[model samples]
Target chain A: MDLIQKGKNYLLEDNFQIRASDNYVNIVSYDKMIHFDNKEVKIQYRNKVITVIGDKLVVSKLVSDEVLVCGMIQKIEFR
Target chain B: MKHYIEVRIEGKNIYRFLKRLNQAKINLYHIRYHGINQAYIKILKEDYEKIQDLKTIYDIKITNWYGIEKGKKIIFKYRFFLLFFLFGLALFIFLSHIVFDVEVVHNDKKLRLLLQEELKKYGISKYHFKKNYDEINKIKKEILYRYRNNIEWLEIKEVGVKYVVRVEERIISKEKEKRPIQNIVSKHNAIILSIDAEEGEIIKNINDYVKPGDVIISGEILLNDKIQKRVSAKGKVYGEVWYKTTVEYPLFYQEQKITGKTKKGWSLSLLNKRIELFSFSPFRHKKIFSKPILKSNLLPISLNYERQKELLIIEEALTKEEALEKAISYARDKIQKSLLEKEKIIDIKKLKVDQNNSKIIVELFVTVYQQIGMEKKIEEIKKDVRDH
Candidate 1:
C-alpha cells in the first residue's frame, strides 16, 4: 500500500485491541464473528479465537475494523 | 460523525443476516438482540438503499433516524405547515404597518383638501409602508416647516392603520380690523359663463371676454358713471376657457393586454441578485411583481414573493376615423392632468389632421368650464393708476 493508504487503513491489521470490563468488552480489529447468541459471542483474529461468555450479551457496535460488545461480561478466553 | 438510520430486522436466523451484511462491507451499530431471530441495528444513512438491494427473507422496518439526518427528516415532513405559518406572520406584519386611509379633520372643505394634498406629498399617503419611526417623524417635521405660513399648527396622528390630521389656519389680527379692499380678476382669458356676487358690483356680463389680470368684479360701487363707495369683492365667476394641443398615435397598433392569470411564488434575494424558489413554469411573456416575505437586518438575505402575470398582444390596423378619435382622446388626457377635480373638458373639436407613413397626428381645440376668479388687493390698482 502507499503511505497514505497504509495510514488510512490503520485499524485493519492482523492484531486485535481487546478491552474488557466487568460489564462490557470492546474489541477493535476483529477478523470475523464466528458465533453469536445471547449467552456467548465468539470472534476470530488470524486463526485465533476470543470467546466472550456472559449473560444478556449484545454487540453494541459492530464493524469490520472494530466491535464493541456490551453486556455483563463474565469471562474472556483467548485460544 | 456519520448519519445513520435505526432499523429492526426480523427473520429466521438473523445472526446469519448480520454476518451476511458484514461480508458485504456494511457497518451496523447498536445491535440489540430482541429474540433468537430478530435484532435492532443502525446502519449508515447512505447504506440504507444498499440494504434493500440485498433482497433477502428478512423484513426490515425503519424505526428512527440518527445524527443530522433526524433534523432534516422532521423538516421535510412538516414543510407545508411551516410555509403556511411563515406566510401568515408576514401578512400580519405587512397589514399592520400599511397606511390604509388618510383623514383631515376640518370644517373648511378648502383647507381640508389643501392639507390632504400636502400630506400626500410627504409620503403619508395611502397604501405606503415606511422604513423607521425616525423617518416618519422627519416627514412630519418637513410638512410642518413648509406650511408654517398657511397653517398655524399641523398634527398627524396615526390611529389603527389610519392618519388623522388636525390643522389650525393662520389668521392675521391686523387684517381683521376693517374691510380689506380687494378685487376679483380673471386668471385666464375666457368668456364669462355665470357670476354669483355676494359683496361686489359685477363689471363683466355673461358671454363677455375678460383677459387675464382684468377686473371682472369691481370693488368700486358705481351709480350713474360715478364711484360712490369701495368695498372688498367677494364672489365666484365661472368661465369657459380653451386649450389647443396635438397628439400622435400609431395607425397600426399592437396592444399588450394583461390576461389576468396570476401565479404567486417565493424567491430569495441577496443585494440585487434574486433567485426564485418554488416557482412554476412562467408564461411565455409575463411580468413579475415581488414583495418581501422574510427579511433580516443583520444579514443580506431576504425572502421575497414574486407574482407572475401573463400578457397577451393583439394587433390591429385602425381606420382613419378610428385613429383620429384615438388622437383626440389622447390630447384630452394630456390637458386633463393640469386641471382641478371640479374643472373638466366641456367640448372637443378636431382642428386639423396630419397623416404620415406609419403614424397619424391630430390637432384638437378643447374647451373647459372652470373657476376663473383670483383675488387682488386694491392697493395694487391704486399704485398702477398713480404710475400711469
Candidate 2:
C-alpha cells in the first residue's frame, strides 16, 4: 500500500542471504544472531544456520533484518 | 538514516555491550577496540538515543558528530561574509553597464551643443544604459534625418563606459548665377605671360605689363562697339612675378647628445597636479610616456612612465660654404611658399651677403611664373568709380 511497505516486502522475499568479501560480510533478511565472538559468528534464519570465522571480527552494521561484518575474514559455512 | 556519531564506551565487558546493542536492532558501523575495557563505535543518532537506557550497564559518551550536521554549523558561522561577497559582485555587474560620460567630438561649439542636446533626447546621456549596436545605429539615423540640413554625417561609438558622437556639418555654396557681373583683375604687379579665358573676353595680351587692380579680362560683352550683355568673369591669367627675401643663419649651433642613461617610474596625473607613485629620477632631463588605466575622458587617472636621459650639449661652428648655403636656401624657401601650385621658379639671383659676428645674412631676388588674376564684382568697381 505505501512505498516503504512495498520495499520491505520485496527485500524480505528471501528467507536469508549471506555475502562475504575479503574484508566484509553482509547478511540480509536474517531472523537473529545466535553467537558472536572475535574469531567466529553464528547467525540463524528460517530453518538454516550461517557461521563466519575470521580474525578481529567486528560488527560494523546491525539492523532488524540486515547485518554487516568487517574483519580479516577467513571462512564462512552454512547448514 | 545514516547520521553517524562517534561514541566511547567504558566498561569491563565491551563485547557484552556490543552484543546487547546488536540484539536491540541498532545499526552500528566502524566499531573499533580501543583497549581491554574501552571501545569506540559509530552509530546512528536515533540508535544512540535508544542506547541511553543501558547507561547503567556501560558508560557512554559522544565524542564527535559528522556528515551534513557539521556542514550546516560551519555555514551558519560565516553567513555575514557570504552576504557581503554577493552584494559586492552584484554592484560590480550593475556599474559596468552604466555610461559615465557622453562626448560630442566636434570643433564648432554650436554643433557640439546641438549634438549633445539631440543625444539627450534619445536617453543617451550620463548614467544611462549604453545602447547596443543596432539601437545606436537607429538613433544615428533618426538624429541625422531630424537635422538633415545641419548634419551631413553622424556616428555613435562606445568607448569604455562612455559614448562618443562624431558629426559633420553641411556647408551650402552660393550659386554663381545669382552673383553680379565681375571682371578678372591683376592681384599682383606683373607682366602677363599667357591667358585662358573661360567665360570672359581677354583684355590683356602676352608681354603686357599690368599694375594691381588692372583688368586682365572684361565681363562686358560687346557687339560692333555697342554694349550687349554682362556676365560673371572667369579665367586664369599666368604672369611673371618677382619677390625679394632676406634670411639670416647662425654660424654656430648647439646640439644635444643622449648619454643613454634612463630610469623608469610611475606617476598619476589628476587635472593639473601629478603625484609620482615611484621614486624620483636623479637626472634633470627626462621623457615621459603615459597610458591610462581607465580609458575614460571624465576620469583623469593614468599610469605615467618617465624615462630620464642624460644630455651632452656641444657647440659646433659651421664652415663658410655651409653658412652661405643655409642662408640662401632659407631665403628661397620663404619666397617659394607664396607662389601658386602650378608656378615654377624661373630665376634666382643673390643680391648681397652680409657676414656678422656670429651669423650670415643673405638677400635673394626670385622670379616665378604663376596665376595673378582675381575676380572683382561690378558693384565694388562702381563704388570705387563713384568715390573717385
Candidate 3:
C-alpha cells in the first residue's frame, strides 16, 4: 500500500513525460502497474499529497525508465 | 481541469499510430475512424501541447473541429421539431378516424340486407374510419364471396377513409289486366249526379230512371243489335225526381230562454284511445239540461272532441196563437229536407187536431211532386278501340 501511495504521489507531484491531447494522453512508466476506475486518485507521501482528476489512472513497469501516469482522461469538474 | 483536444489526420498509418497511443495508457472518447489511412480523435486538453509535439513523428493534420460542435448543437435543436411533428401526426390520425364514412352495395336486396347486418356487426356503419379500410375490405370480400351468385360487382373504395356503396335492383315490369266491371249505382234514391271513370263506359241517358245494378250500360259492346267487341263504358246521368213529407207538432209545449253563456276548455288523447271531453257535474235542478255537439275531421290531427254546455234558461208557457204558428213553421221545415228536384208544393191544409190533458196533437196534409217506383237499370257498356 505504501508503495502504491508512493507511486501515486510520484505521478501527481512529479512532472512525468506525457503527450497532451484533446481527449486522452500517452505516458511512459517504470513502476509496477496501478489500476483505478475513475476514483481514489491520490498519492500521499509523509505530509505531502499529489491529487489527479480523470476517469482512470494506471501505472506500468516498462523499459522507459519513468513512471507513466497514463489515463489522463478528462475529469468531470463543475465551474 | 482536463481540457480535451480533438485531432484529425489526413495521412496514412494513422490507425497504427492511434493504437500505439492507446497502448501507452491513453483513453479516447468521441473518436471516429474515417478510413484506413485517415482518423479523427479527441484527447484531454492538458495533453494538447504534448500531442502537437508528435506532429512531426506522425503524418497527422488537425483539421477544423467543426463536426463535434455541430453534433452537440444538433441534439438540442432537433428535439423541438421532433416533438412538434409527432404532435401534429397524432392529431391528424385522431380526426381522420372521427369523420370517415362507409357504404355497402349489393345487387340482390336479400344479400344487401345480409351484408348490412354483417357490417353493423363489425362496427363498419355509415360513419366509420378510413384507417380501418384494410380490415373492412377483408370483411367485404368475405361477404361478397359468400354471396357470389347474388352479387355481380363488389368494390371497396376509400377517400381519406370514407366509403360509399350504391346498389342496383333487377326486376320486370308487367301491365295490369282489366277485371270484370261491377256497376256502381246510387245507394240512396239519388240521381246519377256525376261519374269519375278510371276505366269504364257510360250507357244511361239523362232523366232515365235507374234501379240498383240494372245495366244502365253494358260493358259488353254490341254492334247492329249483335255482340261484336267488349269495352267498359262509363259516365254519369242526372234525373229529375220528387219527394214529399209532413211533420206534426203539439199545440202546447214548454220553451227555454237562452242566456247565451259558455265555458271553454280543451283536452288531448292518444290515437284510437277514447277520452271524455268534459267532466260531469251532479248538481242543480232536475229540469236543467245540456247539449253536446261532436265535430271531427281527418285534417285536424285530433281524434275527436265534444263541445257540450248548459244553457242558462227560464221556462215559459206558450199561448194558443204562438203554439199554432210554431207548429206550422215546424211542419214547413220538415218538408223542406224531403223536397225533390223540380218538385213544387201543390197545397198545404190543416187536417185535424186532438187535445189531451196538457198537449194538443195537430196534423196536416202537404202535397209535392214525387215520382213513383219506376226502376231503371244501369247497364255496363263495353267499347272496342282501334288501338288494339
Best by DockQ: 1
| Candidate 1 lDDT tens digits, B1-388 | 7888998999998877887787788898778778777888899988888788773889988888987788888888998988898899999988988899999988899999988887777677899863356876787678778877778877778888988888888876666556678899999989999888888888899999999888989898999999898899989998999888788899999989999998888889998897878666867777889898889999999998888899998998999889988888777787788788667889999888999988998888889999898888899978977998
Model 3 docking category: incorrect
lDDT tens digits by residue: candidate 2, B72-164: 656777789878888988988788788999999989999999889889999899999888888998999999999998999998988898988
Chain A accuracy as TM-score for every candidate = 0.79, 0.79, 0.33
lDDT of 3 by residue, B63-140 (tens): 433445546556667978878888999988777776356556654667667667766676666665443657857877
Q: What global local distance difference test value does model 1 have? A: 0.84
Task: Name the runs in model 2 displaced over 4 angstroms.
Answer: A1-10, A31-51, A77-79, B1-20, B29-48, B51-74, B104-112, B132-134, B150-160, B164-177, B181-388
Candidate 3 chain A: 10-residue stretch with minimal lDDT: A59-68
Docking class of 2: acceptable
- How many clashing residue pairs are found in candidate 2? 1
Worst 10 residues of 2 chain B by lDDT: B287-296
Give the candidates in order of lDDT, highest first.
1, 2, 3
Which TM-score values does chain B get in all models? 0.46, 0.51, 0.36
Clashing pairs for model 1 are: none
Error of 1 at B283 (Å): 58
RMSD of each: 21.8, 12.9, 18.9
